[model samples]
Target: MAAPFSAVPTPFRVRAADRWWYGNCAWDAFGICAALHVDGHIETVCADCREPIVVEVRDERPDDQRLLFHCLVPAARWWADIVFT
Candidate 1:
């Protein structure tokens, strides 16, 4: 078995589309994504086809965070049913 909390490998880093493809395989997948040293990182995908279409990231202001998203589908403005607790 591997160490409990080892650093993420370079090969493990993938784009949002790649991550979705590998993650939602015939089997199953879940987890988290972390940028090595980027700030205000955000990603989005089309809800219908589950395709990644947007990604925003930067190095300045690593602590600052923001996200902007919208859905093209009518009757729905947000892609996923986001509910902040």
Candidate 2:
């Protein structure tokens, strides 16, 4: 007889373009921290272009917009609108 079924794992999906898409900056950072499960400043590369990516969680001001947005080139800037907002 076949074995009883169990809860199956679903595929984790992330768009290839999102790494460069400015709107997904938060999502990208969130994913990185979640993936590494680390604390403090983190330095990594963009998943798409391999450019440097830096994130820091520390004693900081909440009003800082730099924490969310980035100055991307014209191509990426086109998709910079915050999707969740």
Candidate 3:
């Protein structure tokens, strides 16, 4: 259970550096690319509709504008119950 990377399958996935990496969440997906400092493609599904979603990241910035990241729990409390967060 890596922080930005997951040991098991998850909705968030990143394809970068010629390998596939599973991410724990949306933020982590991008973090994987940022940490590697390489362009990446992210694949996931919309939570509400289950529709496929893809995002591209270059130079640590996401290319898509139709994306949003929201967290109900504040960043300070994320680690308290990370499994639920």
Q: How much lDDT does each candidate structure score? A: 0.30, 0.37, 0.90
| Best by the TM-score measure | 3
Query: All candidates' TM-scores?
Result: 0.23, 0.27, 0.92
Tens digits of lDDT, candidate 3, 1-85:
8678899999998999999999999989998998788999999999999999989898777897777799999999999998788
**What's the best-to-worst order under TM-score?**
3, 2, 1
Model 1: worst 10 consecutive residues (lDDT sum): 21-30
Query: Model 2, 1-85: lDDT tens per residue?
Result: 0111113221222222223212234444345334434333434566569776655533322223465444455544545653332
Instruction: For candidate 1, give the lDDT of residue 46.
Output: 54
Model 2 steric clash pairs: none
Per-residue error at 48 for model 3, in Å? 0.7
Which runs of model 1 end up more than 4 angstroms from their true locations?
1-13, 16-35, 39-44, 48-52, 60-66, 69-85
Residue-wise lDDT of candidate 1 within 1-85, one digit each (tens)? 1211124332122233333222221111112223233232233455469766444334433223464334344435322532210
Q: In angstroms, give how far residue 28 of model 2 lies from its true place.
A: 9.7
State the TM-score for model 1.
Answer: 0.23
